[model samples]
Structure formats: structure tokens, C-alpha cells
Target: MDGKRVLLVEDDSAQSSMLQLELKRRGFRVNAEKTVAAAAARIEKEIFDAVVTDLRLGSGDGLQVVVAVKASQPETGVIVITGHGSIDTAVAAMKAGAFDYLTKPVEPEVLALALRKTIEHRDLVGEVRRLRAEVKERRGVSGIVSASDAMGRVLALVAKVSSTDATVLVTGESGTGKELIARAIHENSPRRDGSFVAINCGALPEGLLESELFGHVKGSFTGADRNKRGLFEEASGGTIFLDEISETTPGLQVKLLRALQEGEIRRVGDNHPVKVSARVVAATNRDLMKQVTAGKFRDDLFYRLKVFPIEIPALRTRVDDVMPLAEAFIKKARVRTGSPATHFSPAAAKALRSYAWPGNVRELEHAVERALIMAGGPTVEARDLPPEIASSAPAKRRVKAKPPRKSRR
Candidate 1:
């Protein structure tokens, strides 16, 4: 604060003189005002790093200074000083946008420290806003990286549903980017700053999954030593993405349904229920409705989770995006693997487009990574692709384009 300017407003002449002298000695430029009107007018015409004012100004209020400072320069910090027993009035000043409050008999050291903290905090908040804006510009719509009409429609739905509090169910074949879609919705939603907890339901047994979702009390079961907060609690204001949701048992489905309906979860071995507000976004590779019909899944839970269903198209179906996605993957994979390849050869493009990619987008990403590692030149050739994709190149692209007849016209 070597050259930082401060505005001091106090009706008491001697107190104002002492405070201004001490602030100047501590390396601040101080401007003294005898009333609230003078301070507010100065704030309107100029900018200061901070303002120090008495809670009770003669025939005027210190809150007027705070209002003036905030209206003109919202980033400026305000500090209010009050008598020893006027904490209530000081708190009211704080509610009016004062940065800090000091009771009477204010020490110069304490005021200096408070000023420094307030300015530092202002700078930190500004930087955070700048960085968040930069990220939003760089990654459009959560960065799904697709350019097909089919995928475009899916992205449109994602954009629409992200603004509301809705339970989403994403369905597609394995490796068709279901989880990616779920994450896109969460990142674009209002709860983006909150926790994004994900887990694969099929990866855990029924008892373990129960404890993991709702938590368990200490000594609830064998090896239970301490109380644990579960994923639902961790995702209190954000999203919880459950993958392979079809794999959950029927009993677990009943509990999940209750949680959805009641906005609460009962921890294992605990009678009390804890409130939770996490948005659920579940993904599955199977026909959930079919499972419900066959009695393998709970019908009530199925309907609850499918409030906003999104079905991702398989990779082979959006053939128009194949080459574009391959190129994008190459940009990332080449940096990771230190590959010399820069682009795909015509033969390589044909192989990528013709093959029925059963494994979908995930498989395409891995294929590009593998090709980049195996390629020897600047171009990725058909032979560099996986055996299944390399041998399935279509016959049409194999033939050269017919050149225009010489002078036929």
C-alpha cells in the first residue's frame, strides 16, 4: 500500500488529524473529510483504494458514503468505525457493503492490515472472474467435439436441459459418449462449481454400493471404523453421475427411488434420513425399459430417473463426423505420444469411415491414438489402423476420381 489512496471521514477534528498522520506515516495517501456530504462528493468524482468513515456523521449517515462509493465504484472497499458499544450499528454498516468495522480507539496497525486485506481480496475476485470467462470462451458448450446433424440435435437438447434442475438419463451403446453427454450437461448447468461425483454401479456389489451412495455409520458393519460421508452428500449442490445404472439391484432401486422422491437418503444402519439436493444423471448401455418390463428393474425408479432422457447416436450412424473427430484426436494424441504424424491419408480416412464401429466414439479415439503411435511418416496410412478397420476399407474410395474429359466441351 505504498501509494494507495484512502479517504478518511470523521467529524471530530483532533481524531481525524491523528488518524490521517498515522496513515501517512505508514505509507498511505490520506484525504480527510469533515462530513458525509464531502466524502460522498469526493467518492463520486474520484477513485480511492479504501474509505474509512465514522458510523455516525454530523447531520448525516456513514451508510450514505458506502452507497455512494458502491454506486460509482463497486470494487472500492469501505471500512466503518463506531463507538465501543455500537457493534449493532457497525454490523448495519457492513450489511450496507462496508468491508470491515472497527470499534472506537482504533489502532493504526489494525486499520492498515484491514485495508491491505480488502484490496487483496478485491484483486483476487477480479482475477477469478477473468479466468472463468476465458475458459468459457475456449471450451464451447462443454466441449463435446462433434459436427454431425444427429449430434447437433443431441447437443441442442443438452443445452436446453442444463439450465433447469432435472434428473437426466443418457442412453447409448457402450463407448457411444453417454458419460461425456452427462458431464456436458453438468458443466453447463448452474451447479458447475459444485462437486461432480461419478461412479460405476456395476463395478460394486450391492452392500458396498449402498454404503458408497448413502454412507454408513461407524461400526455399522465389519471393517467400519469411522463415519463416512457418501457420494450423495459430496454432490449436495452439484451432480452425481451413475454409470451402468441398470446393474443396480431391485432393493437398491427402491432406496434410490425414495431418495429421488423425498430429497433425502438413509445411511446404512442409521434410522435418520439426511437431506440431499444433488441432481442425478444416470447413463446405461442396456435397455432400461426392457429390464423394467422383465421385472429386473424397478418401474417406479426407472420413471424417476428418466425425467429428461437423452439418447446418443452410435458413432457409425454419424459417419459425417468421423474424419473431423479423428483429426481432433490426432492433435491431442500426437502431443501425448510424441508422434510425427500430422494428418490422415485418403486410404486411412476411407478405412475409418467404412468400418462399422461397434465400439463407437471411444473406440475411434483409441484407434487414432494407436495409429499416431504406429505411423512412421507425417501421414497416418490405412495400415497404421487396427486390423479390423484397416481391412474393411470401402471399394468406392479405392478408385481414383475420374478426371474431366480433355476439351470435351
Candidate 2:
């Protein structure tokens, strides 16, 4: 806090001078005002790091000064001093947003300590603001590139559930943009100001997945070295997105159900349960109902997850969107590789539209990227596509042999 500015408001000239000298000695820029009116005027004209004021000015109380200082600059910290200290007066000063209260004949050390604490608090506040700004910049939505009805419907569901705290189950084939929709929901919800914690249920084994979601106490397992907070705890008051929920084992499903119902979770090897307020949004490609019938998933758990279900349509069903999706992917790939301008020829577009994309949007993206690298000119022709895609035409036209002729003979 060296070279920080401070405003001192005191009617006593000698005390004000001594405080100013001490603050200046500590490398602070000190400004001394003899009355509440002068302090208020000075504050209106300039911002200060901290303000120190006596309760009784020559003609007015410093409570008014506190109010004015806070009104003018809400970020500034205020400290109140009183010679005739009383419980009521101190309470009132604090209620008016005073950072600290000091009794008369205050020790310089105590005063210095309060000032140091206030400065540190201000620094923490600034850091939080900076972090929030960075998140906003990174996740800010301008224009998402989807024009297909499938993507449009997904976006609509996101908007609807973004305003509610209901658990959302997003179901789609792999690479159909499940994570993108999850982020959109988080950004539009009231929890947008908080963190969005995501975990893939299939990414880790059962034991690790449990610890990852619920955290664990020190030495909870063989490798546990310290107490670790789980994704649910870290996402408290925010959203936890569980991707590929179908991959979770039956045992873990029971534990997750309990946590969802009770709004609390127990860390592995820990007896104590920690309460959480995180909203859950789970996604999967497999049919939980089918899995439940096969005894791979719990029936009750499936119902709980489907409370606000949103099914994402496969890309093949949205034929009109193929051209747009391909164009977008080509642009993205080109920008990433610093390649020259590129476009698909009419024949190439026709082949893309006619073929069934078994791998969905992800496969189309890879095709476009590969074609961009293979095509020499600006236009990507049918020959530029992978052999699988180019051979789609022959497969579509195959005729059945004349089995009937043999029967007639």
C-alpha cells in the first residue's frame, strides 16, 4: 500500500497533524481536513484509499462524513475514532459502513493494523472483480454458428431451463455439441456469475469418479495425501455438468441419487456430509430406460434425470443444415491452419447432403478439415472428399440380383 492516498477528518489540529505525519512516514499520501464539511468536499473531488475521521467534528458528527464518503466512492474504506466511546455509538458507526472503530488515545500500532487489514481486503476485492471480468470475456456469446432446426431446438431448451433450477438431462449422440449446450445454459442462468464445473462420468473409474464428485479426506485411499474438495463442493451455488452419465456404474448411480435427493454428499472415507446448492445437468448418448430394463441403470434414477430432458437430433435428420454446418467447419478449420480461402463445389455439396452421416456433426467437421488440406484450389470437388464419402453414390444405386429368374426356371 505504499504511496496510497488517505483522507483524515478531525477537528483537533494537533492530533490530525500527528496522524498525517505517521501515515506519510509509512509512504502514504496523506490529506488532512479540519471538519466534516471540508472532508466531504475533498472526497467529492478525489478518490482515496482509506478515510480516518473522528466521531465529533467542530460543528457536525462524522457519521454524515461516512455516509458522504461511501456515497461518493463506495470502494473507499472508512475508520471512525471516538474519545467518548459507547456501545451504541460504535454500533451506529459500523452500521454506517465504517471499516473499523478506535477508542480515544488509540495506540499507533492498533491504528496501523486496522489500516493494513483494510488495504488487504481492498486488494482481494479487486482480484475478484478481475477474475469475473476475465470469465465474462471468455464465455461471452455473440453469435453461435448453428442454423439447423436441431440446433435451434437445443438452444431453445437451453433458454427455457436456464431460468429454472431443475435438473436437465441432455441426450445426444457423441460429438453433437453437448458441452456447447451445457455452457450456453450456464451462461444464461442466474448462476452465470458463478463457475461451471463439468465432469465426464466415463472418463474415470468407479472409485476415482466417486472421489472426484464427492471429494475425500486426507488418507481416504491409498494415494490420498491431503483433503481434496470434489467437483460438487467446488461447484456449490453454481452448476455441475455430468457428461456421459450412462457410463457411471450402478453403485455410483445410487450414491448420486442420494445426493440429488438430500442436497448433500459425503466425501469418500469421511463420515461428515457436506451440504451443496449446486444445480445438476447431466448428458448421455445411450437410452437410460433401455439400460434400466437391462439392470445396467436404476429405474428411479432414470426418472430423476429425465425430469427436464432435452433430446438433441442427429445431424442426418437435419439435411438442410448440412451445407451451413460444413461451411462453418471449413471456415473454422481454415482459420486455425492459416489456409487460403476455400469452398465446396456443388457436386461435393450434393454428396454431403445425400449420404447418411453416421458419426454426425463431428464426422462432417473432420471431412471438411481433411478436404481443405487435400484440395489445391479454392473449390473442393467430389474427388477431394474421402473415399468413403465419394463411394456413397455407388452404394445408393446397387440393384438386387435376379433371384426371381431362378425360381421361374
Candidate 3:
């Protein structure tokens, strides 16, 4: 907040001098102007963190100054001051892009507080803009929808680690886009030109899982009639995403550990080992460390997969991402179903933001799709949402239930 440049536009010389002295004392660089034309010129020629102007100027109205400052630097905060303060004037000032309204003979402390708040708002707007730009840069490639600062940091980490061949372990609740992150890493890596094979370890039996991952020779098992390539082999020179890695049996864990340590795998029926250049990216919703301690998961395998761990935050933790994600999903739904729904109503958006999404991003995507289908108009209203979401009470509901009265004799 200190040393922030301010453009002061006031026609009253005495008032301008007093305000400038106070602001300078408070560590602001003040540039005083007496007319709207001078302030407009300063705004165009120089940059400022905030503009403090009187509603009434000598030559022209301060609204002109506000408009000029906003046109030049929309991020700059504008505070309007006036001797004849009224509701209409305040509303007009705000409509003209004033950040705040202050009456004449304002207290120094009040003015300072307003300035601080305005600066904070400007900073937040700037940060959101930066994050949006970053998200836009990797929009379709990352396939991630987020506005929260936490997810921004996660994306930053993804960018840093995607260039390397280091093994990555993504830990998050089910449906939190763990596989998407893995794909993002692969897409941005040197192996992006090659195949990106993914399989859910928990979705297959132990015996079949081994054959699916390590491959099997012809007639290796009862169902094996022909030679088959495993994910590791299919993904050779690329990346292999092993989702639900924690679900692998203990015996399979040893084989996985061997693959990670030695960069080799043995087919089920073959005696010779095959070298694989695939970069392994694993994910799990369970606590692998706890499984290691309980003897359910091999300790060595756990350590190998945990080399470069990335934990995704749950949807409840990144509530700021909810609306953007919902909007993105709505757009996707429109394309998939050829729906006419273009947006969510205010009530529907409120319901979305208020709900605690236990199923994370996957759940939100599905919900938006459902709402789009159920919507009658171009916008998705609260009634178009899922039953649980539509029926849930508002966040500000404070009416408590009355206690049940005993039946009178």
C-alpha cells in the first residue's frame, strides 16, 4: 500500500493541499490537478494505482475524470469526493466506474481505509486476470478449469515438471481430475509425440492386470490365444498412466517396483526381460502411506511412486473454481447434446456455489450436463438442477425448526 501513486483532482486549492499533504504523509505519491482536463491528461500520460477526485471540478465535472481514468487504466481505483453528497450522486459516481464515494471534509482515517480497500480490490482483480491468462494459455491442452489460486500453483508445478521424465504420483479423491493432470504432463512432455496409454489398476483382476501391464506371449494363459502388447510396451517411448495404483495386489506391486527401478519388464510367459522407455505417472485416491504401514502395499513400491507427488485439492476446498467449471461443462454439454442452454440463472449458480461437491470435478461436469438437459429455457434455473441441489436450503437460512409439543391429554 505504501508508495502507491495517486492522481488527485480537486478544484479547491485549500482542500487539495490538505488532502495531498495527508496522503504524502501516509506514503502515497500524490499528483494534484485542478481541472478535469488536467486530470484526464495525467491519466493518459502516466500510470496510477488510484484516482482521488472531487465530483465538482472547476472547468468540467469529475465524472469526466473518472471516465477518462477508467478508459485509460481500468485496473486503477477511482474514489469520488463531493461537498453536496446525495444518494443519486453516489449512485451516478459508482455507475461511472468510481471505486468508492466519500463526502467532503472526510476524516483522514476513513479516507485511508477506503484507499487501502480500493487498492486491495485492484490487486485482487489483477491477480485474477493473471491467473485467467495462464489458464487460457493451457486451456485445451491441460483440460483444467480453475480460478482458485491453489489450482494456479498446481498448474505452475505441472508446467515445471512436464518437461522432465521424472515419475509423478498424483494423489486426490476419486473424480478430482487426476488422470487429466497425468495427460497434461504427458502432452507437455517430450514423449507427447508418442502413445499415452492409461489403465485403471483397480478395474481388473490381479492375473489379468499383470498380463495387461507386462504383456503375455501367445497361449500364455487360458484366454491368451495370440501375442499381446502390454500397456508398458504399448506406451514405450511415451507415458503410461496407472490410475488407482493403490489397488494393485502386493505381488503386482513388486513387479511395478522392479519396472520403475530397473526400467524393464518381463512378459508372463517369456524368460527374457524387455526394456521399456515409458515414463510412469501413477494416481490413487487411497492413502498409500497407510497401506504401506498396514502391509497392504509394498513399502518400496510406495516410495518409488511417491517420488514426485502432486496432490489435487478437493472441490470443496477450491470453491472459487466451481462457477467457471460449471460454465465450461455447460458449454461442453451444449456441444455434445446440441442443447440451447447458454447460461445458468442466478439461483442455479448460487445453488452450485453453496453445495459441498463430494465428487469433485467429475460430479460438477455431470450435474451441469443434467441441468442443461432439464432446462426449459436458454438458461439453467434452480429447478433444472439435480434434486439434491435444487432442494437444498440457501446458505443464509436462519429459521430454526420449532420444538415438537407433547400431545395434550
Candidate 4:
């Protein structure tokens, strides 16, 4: 483990110093305080990785100290030291979020072991909590579902990074769930209730793209009818997803870099600047670094967008997830179209698994829907699939030559 910030609250000077020295010796940055009040002030001012406290400080109960530390920073671990070791107090401390309780005259080895285990357990629990939060947020939205390990990792990263206002770059091929990950981050973040604006950078022309991202005044162009709010302003206190970011022109890249660095955007035909407060998540199917090397994309903009990068894996890479994703899509389609229960045949599922999904999960979804329509029965069969997928079944298996030919030879 790396050096952790530890707040030690103890009334005994010599014992506190000794414990501080031992913790410092074992890769901990110690902050020794004699009173719970002082410890509370320190915790309010700065974050501590863990807190160690004697059960009875000068005039306060260490249980209060544990409660205070946990309240202020729920992520921080608390270890309570008690001299009158009783089962009741220990149970209370643990219930109150104390990572572990140590009795007075505690052995150095025993304390160290408890501290190590508590820290590890706290880290693991934090990770799980973060992941669950991401999943909850992602599921609350409509038309999105995922259970792949790659998506799980992406959610974990999104949870950790969503608390801060950081620029995130989501890289993946088209239909690989980039925008879904971005939505999850936004929904779990402080801006959960705010608007989420998305625009395709590759779909618009240079001038229109600029005007769309940073709104223009009335009569700014031929079709400009009135002063309109751009996506940046519309997404204030929320998130703006820039899809196909690699398609941005050089001039647009410069403008985007300025907006990210300065948090201000100027509308076309308007001299005044508009201050924008929005988290940015840019997604691109192309290799941005390659684009930068080729002088098509700016290096500065690339670096700015990639501050918190997440890569979404294609369906081909996570083939094991096909069946689960298919079932989820079936449920979704059943609800959406008000159709009766629909499912996949074993042959259809086998076909799905064997085929290399060039279009990723999105392709699998469309194929399943198509099969549902074409099937003679309720279940989707291999024959119900399109030629591309159906033709791959026989080719997926290896054919053994006849042994008679070898014998004749």
C-alpha cells in the first residue's frame, strides 16, 4: 500500500507519539492530535485516508470521534482504540463504521494486521459501491442495457471520475456503447437532473457544426431566424456528449480547446462571450492520436479531451456476453412493441455466438428483431436470420475429410 494520511486522536502524549512513529515507519503520513476537536478541524480542512483514536480522549468518547470522522468523510476508515475492552462497545464501534477496534496494551503486530485488513476491505467496498452507483444510474435511463465485463469496468471508471468536472474521452467503434457510458456518468454525477445534450461532430458541415455547438445570433447566416442557445449553454450544469470528435475541423478544434480551457464560448456574429458550466464527454470511433499525427486533429485538443479516457470494447472482443445481451434486448423489444414473449432458438443463439459481429451489440439487437419477425414460430431460429449470419453457421465448424480417401491412398 502507498503512504496513507492518518489522523491519530489520543490524549496520551507518549503513546500517541509511539503509535505515530510506528504508523509512519510503515508507510503512513501521520497527523497526531491530542483532542477530538482538533482532529475534526483537520478532517474538515483536509481528507484523511484513515483515523485512529483512543476510546476516551481528553473529554470526548472515541465513539463520537468515529461517528464524526465517518459522517464527514464516509470513505475514510476509522479504527477505535479501547482500554476497557468489552464486547458491547466493540460491537457498537463496528456498527458505527469503525473499521476495527483495538484494546489497550495492543500488540504492534496485531494492530498492524488489523489496520492492513481494514484498509484493504474499505478499498474493496468503496469500489463495489462506486460500481453499483454507476449501474443504478445507467439503468434508470431508457433504451440502454449492458452486462459485459468491459461495460462493468467502464461503469467503475465512470463512477470514480463523475464526482469531478473532468473532460472525458470515450473511444470505441460505432455502436460499441460509448454514449451509454457517458450517460451513466452524467446520471450518477452531481448534475444528474440536468440536461444531457448530444451532437454528432461528423454529421454537420464545418460552419453549421460551429454554429450548432456555439449558437449564433439572428441573421448570423441565411437560415438563422433567431438567437438560439447552443448545446454548451443548453447543457449547463449537466453534460455535453460530442460524438465522432475526430471529425472536427482544425478551426473547430481550436474553438473547442479554448472552450475547454477557458470555460467560455462565443457565438457566431456575436462579440460577447457566454460563460458555460458543463462537463464534456467526447466520443470518437477513429484513432484521435493518429488523426493528430496526420495534422487532421489538434494535439492540444486531443490531450484536453483525453484527460479521463475510457475505451469501449467491441462485441467481437466480448463474445461471451452475446446471449445475455440478446435476452435483455428481447425483453426490451417485447415491452417496446407490445409483442408477446419472444426468445431465441438454440440454433439462433449458436448462430449469434458464431458470427463475428462487425456492428457490435447494436447489430446483434437489429438481427434479433429481424429474426423475431421472420420466424415461423415464436422462437427465433437460424433460418429466420439474414443470409450473412445464416451462412456463417456451417463455416463456423471444421469439416473432417473421409477416412476412406486416406485408406485408398
Candidate 5:
């Protein structure tokens, strides 16, 4: 057969034989097993592209087969066939790493379609893993530290979009690593070998920002002495990361829209247009939609920048990642300061997770750096944490009390 290798685990002899024959007729190299133990033995000795298993076997539950296949070959797809199918059982199967769940007496065509979809899903996952490994080997993760599912989803989206020349808009709080996301995109994109020019639109005045973005000709202004290349020109054949894009003035927004739409820019004091080839990746902590509604941002520019919108979840929502991020920061801090502090104490970890990180990842990083400096031993204890974090409590809203009424009233 020219199709994939599949292991079919069904307790019933008749059902198992029927499935094996059907799968073989469909071009799959099928191995039929009547028990979970037999399936586990086959998985140990051979690799499969997919596994179709009965949820309840004669000897044991089919979840054991799913676990074994996943443990041995994570790329293998597992589809659970359950006679007693319920939402809870389906959820359990999925949580146990089944690719999909099928109810009892599945139609032959339906089973074939499910197997095809599972194999496709497996291939897609394998491709993502391969791309991630390639990216790590060549360009590192660009210092992006994330272990939470929220960020995992973000990274997956990032990977999928990196191969395209789409304009990306990343929205998050100021210290939530928006620039890091931008860098990761650039590093994994076709423009990896080219320059990645980043400029904060909110960091400069209107006049200077224009000059810096679109370049300036000789004597373009009082301070302009010579012709200078703008960020767009410097980023030709690469990417330009515009941070705090909501801060751009209306006039500058028009220029940005022109560049994004026409792929051309005019230098200051020069009427000649220069063609530039650069991908735009913009970021903002402010709400661009609100800015558009408030007449503070150009609607066209907002649309141009948001071709692919990626919102980063604030660190507070992913508290589970706090300690791992803290540990990573500590490792980097040790390299910078040659400190002996290597880890966080249990109490310190608790304090880190408990605090409301208003400043997000940047705040956590700074806290770790400061704690490393304050720590006198190998580990950072709760006492080493900043008082704001160590003594932090959930924020409470104040309710104003009414003034007491006079008795005469």
C-alpha cells in the first residue's frame, strides 16, 4: 500500500478484522490488535503514522495505547473509537492526547475521512516543530520566554505568518515584549538575513520622527547637514518595526499609509520619491481602534497596519509562567553580573506569582535583576524580593461611604 501505517485496536474480533480489511482496501498498512497490551507491544516495536483504538478494550482502556504512541512518537496521530461516547469521555480522550474521537459503529467513509484528517493534522504539527527547530538552530527564539498556552498560541500564529510578507500589528501593554515578538517574526521570516530596523514612534517629536522615518536630504532642515537614509530605506529588503504606532501624528499617518500602500517614500526637502521594499510590523500599547474613533489616528493607516493582528496576553493572566521567566532572567542576570544567585526560593516564587505585574514582563525582569543583586546567597528568597512584590495583595476597589445624615434631617 502507498498509504500510511496505521495500528487498529479493537477488542471485538469481527470488528477488528473488518476495520483491518477496510483500512487495507483504503491503501493503509493496517495492524489489527484486540487488546491494549498487544497495541502497546506493536507501538514499542514499530512506528505508526496514525492509531485508531477502541476506547474500551478487552484487557484495558484504550487511553493506554494513546499514551504509549504519544510517548514513543509524538508525531503519531491517535483517534479514539468509543461505544459509550459522551462529552466527558471524549474530553478525557482528547486530554490524553487523542487526535480525535469517533462514536461507535463509525461509517467506513467517516472513519477514512477521520484518518485522513488526523494524518494531515499530524503532518502540520510535524512541520511546525521542524520550523521551530530550524528557527532555534539558526536565529534562537530572540529572547522570547513563554511557557503558557496563551503565549504558545501566539507563537504558533507567529510561525504561520512569518513566511508571508504581511503587515503585522502587535498590541499589548508597554512592557509585555511587543518588540520581542516583532524580532521573532523578523528572525523567522524571509528577511532574516536583512536588517531589522525598529523605531518607537512615541519616543520622538513629530519633526524628528518624520526625518528619522523617511530620511532627509542635504540641508533638508536647519540641522540636516547631509543626505541621510531613513529607516525604511535602511530596512530595504528587510523589516521595519514601528513601536507605539498610535502615537503617530495625523500627517505622519498619511505618509505611513502611502509607504505601506505604494511602497515608496519621499525624503524631507526632496520631492523625488524613493521606492523601498520593506515589511512593516507595527506595535501599540494604546487602542488603535479607539484612536481611530477619537480622530487621533488615521483609519486607513490603522487598517494597513493591522493586516495580521496579534494580541499579547499580559503576564498577570499567565501567572504559571512567572517562575520560569524569573529563572530565565536570573540565568541572564548571572551572566551579566557574575552573581551566584541561581534560583528562586519557594517563597520567592510564590511572591513572584502573587504580585500583580502592572508593568508586565519587563517589570518581572527588573525585579529579578534587583533581587539577584540584593541576594547574598545562591538563591533568591522572599526577603530578596522587592517590598512591593513580597507584600503585594490583590487590588481592591475603594467604595466611597456616604456622609452620616444629621438627626434633624
Candidate 6:
């Protein structure tokens, strides 16, 4: 508690002096005040670790100081001092935001212990809030590594729409970090404190996908032995990321559209609607407009999901991010793999920069991991890279001719 600041508010001059002396002996820096107005002004001017106020002041009650401290800095803990039979009033003060109460004819030792514990609790709460902020900075827009102007615009769009509840559609090639962008939006949103539920729509069959998304009631299906909540309910108060959303059948899209439009969902077995408040953030490598034109995806649902669209440029188009991204991946892997390699040699760096990463960011991460394993020393040589990435400039020209396409008609 050494050097911790405290606000001491008491009308009795003699008692205030004695208490201040004891607190100072215990290493506290006390700012003493005799009235509620003075203490309130002090609180507004400075932030203290804790405030100890007498319940009865000459001009005003201690509750006023408590309210002032809370309004100015909610994290500051408050301890109210009361006389013999003022227990009810002290309780009311606590309800008004005071942390703890002490009876009159205060014992210095007791007051010291209470202040210590209150300050410790306040510190713990402050630390938790700080960690939450770190999450937003680490996982939010600022954490994304990008050097290309196209990527900068994508991040700017993310920043603009993150604080709003608008539905987000992230269109990009596979392995282009669409999910990462979705997470950035969620972390920076007002719903950051809530759960982030993600499901790959194409990974599950239609029946199972429907059940998994909206949950299932017991006896709804052969394997559903018990009632289960769906992803929408689970993600209530937060954002849900739907990957490969274009893979959904038109039937499932109808349920999804209702959920998005009405803020409600129907479980697979139950007819009664269950309300859900999960924000939707959907991603697809396939173009949904084309899907709509081809009669594969619903146009109404497409428009709903496209309210705030963000398209991540392919890695081949943003070649400037390659080397920096490679170095970042290397640094991130060092702690886990304990790899001695810190960077690539001149030739290896050239290969990494020259190659067209059709697989985008995900592919680059894997390539860096591969190089670390293959390298014999602290510096990774060109031979340590994958065969395609290590090839000459002419070979890259052939590979970069066109992005590999998905197997579809």
C-alpha cells in the first residue's frame, strides 16, 4: 500500500487529524477534507485508490462524497464511517456505491486493514478491465498486419462498422483471413464481452447444420437425446461468424433470413419461436451475387448479409505485406517451436517476396513453419522453403498467371 493515494473526508477536525496520522504511518498519502463539497471537488480533480468518508459531515452527508467518487472514478473503492446507531444509514451508503462501512470511534488498525483489502480488490478489478482492453487492441483492427493500400481500406471499413450492429459480409478468397477480420470486428464492437460463436456452414450436412445452428429438442431426431441450444442462442449478446455461408440450402437460408430479420429463431423440433440477439457476420469465398443470379442463393438474404461488406484482397495482389507477414509468423512461432531461426537469408527472403501466394495468409503461415523446420541454422535459406516458393522468377510468372480455381461447374 506504499504511496497509495486516498481521499479522507470527515467534519471532526481532531478525529480527522488522528486518522490521517495513522494512515500516513501506514504509508498512505492522504488528502484530507472537512466538507462534502470540498471532497467532491477533490474527487473530480484527482483519482485516488480509495476514499474514506464519515457518514455525518457538518454541511452534508458522507453519501454525497460516495456518489461523487463513484461518478468521477468508479474504480475507486469507498469506505463509509458511521456512528453507533447509524448502521442503517451506512447500509444505504453501501447501496449507493460505498465499498465498506466502519463504525464510529474508529480503530486505526481496523481501518488500515479495511483500506488495504479494499485497495487490493480495486486493483484486481482494474487489472481485469485492463486485460479486456488488451484483448481489443491485440485482436482488433490494430493487431492486423497489413502494408498494402487495399488492406488499409479493408481495415478502415472494419473500424467504421465495428461499433454498429449492422450485419457484416466478408467476401474473400480462401485462406485470406476472413475469420480474422470478423473477429476484429467483434472484439472492437460493444459486444466484445460476449461469446463469439463460429460455424462453417459447408462443413455439416443440411439436416445436421440446421440442427446445429438452431439447436434441437429431445426426440427431434434419432441422435438428439436431449434438448440443445443453438449457436444463435449461444451467441446471444455477441456476434456469430458463419463461414462458407453460400453453401447453405435455400431452405436453411429462409430460417437464417427470419433470424436476421426478426431477431428470433425456431429450433429444429419446436414450433414456438425462441428469441435470439446474436449479431450476424457471414463470410464466403464464393461470390453471392453470382450465386443469386444462378438461382443458388437467395437475393433477399444476400442483400441482408451485404449491409456492410468487406472484401479482403488476395495475397498476390498485396505483395507488399509478404515479407512483414512472414517475419511476424516467424516471431509468433519462435516461442512454441523454440526455433533458433529468426529470419530468412537474402535469397530466401527474395523467394518469399517473389512467389505469388495463391493460398494467401494461411498458406504463408504454413510456409514459414515449414521453413523453420527445414532450416539447419539461425537463417533459413531458399532451399528450406517449399519447392514452389523457392523456384526462380520465370517459374513464378507461370504460377501467377491465374489463381487456382475451386472444383465447380
Return the top candidate by TM-score: 6
Which wins on lDDT, candidate 1 or candidate 6?
A: 6
The candidate that achieves the highest lDDT relative to the unseen native structure: 6
lDDT of 3 by residue, 89-193 (tens): 778889999999999788767887888889999999889989967764553354788699988988887888899999999999988889899989888888877
Ranking by lDDT: 6, 1, 5, 3, 2, 4
| TM-score preference between candidates 1 and 2, better one | 1
Candidate 1: where is the Cα deviation over 4 Å?
Answer: 2-5, 8-42, 54-63, 81-92, 102-107, 127-140, 159-167, 186-196, 226-239, 250-266, 270-279, 287-308, 320-409
TM-score of each: 0.68, 0.64, 0.63, 0.62, 0.63, 0.73
Model 5 lDDT per residue over 92-196, tens place = 889999989999888777888899998988888889989977766645464677789998989998998899999999999979889889988998898988899
- The 10-residue segment of model 4 with minimum total lDDT is 400-409
lDDT of candidates 1 onward, in order: 0.90, 0.85, 0.88, 0.83, 0.89, 0.92
Candidate 2 has a TM-score of 0.64
lDDT (0-100) at residue 389 of candidate 5?
A: 97
- The residue-by-residue lDDT of candidate 2 on 193-289, one tens digit each, is 6779999999999999999999999998899999999999899888999999999999999989987889889999999889988889999999888
Residue pairs with colliding backbones in model 1 are none
> Candidate 4 — which pairs collide?
none
TM-score of 4: 0.62
Give the local distance difference test score of model 2.
0.85
Could you report the Cα RMSD, in angstroms, for every candidate shown? 6.0, 9.5, 19.7, 15.8, 17.2, 7.2
Residues 1-409, candidate 4, lDDT per residue (tens digit)? 4687778899999898888888877887888888878878888888887888888887778788888888889888888888788768888889998988889887766766777777787789999989977766545443355567776787778879888899999998888888888887787788977888999999999999999899999998898999988999999999999999998899999999989999999999898999999899999989999998999999989999989999988888877688888888777676766555478877778778888889887898898777666766667778888879876754432566553443310
TM-score of candidate 3 versus the correct structure, residues matched by position: 0.63
Q: Which portions of model 5 show Cα errors greater than 4 Å? A: 1-139, 393-409
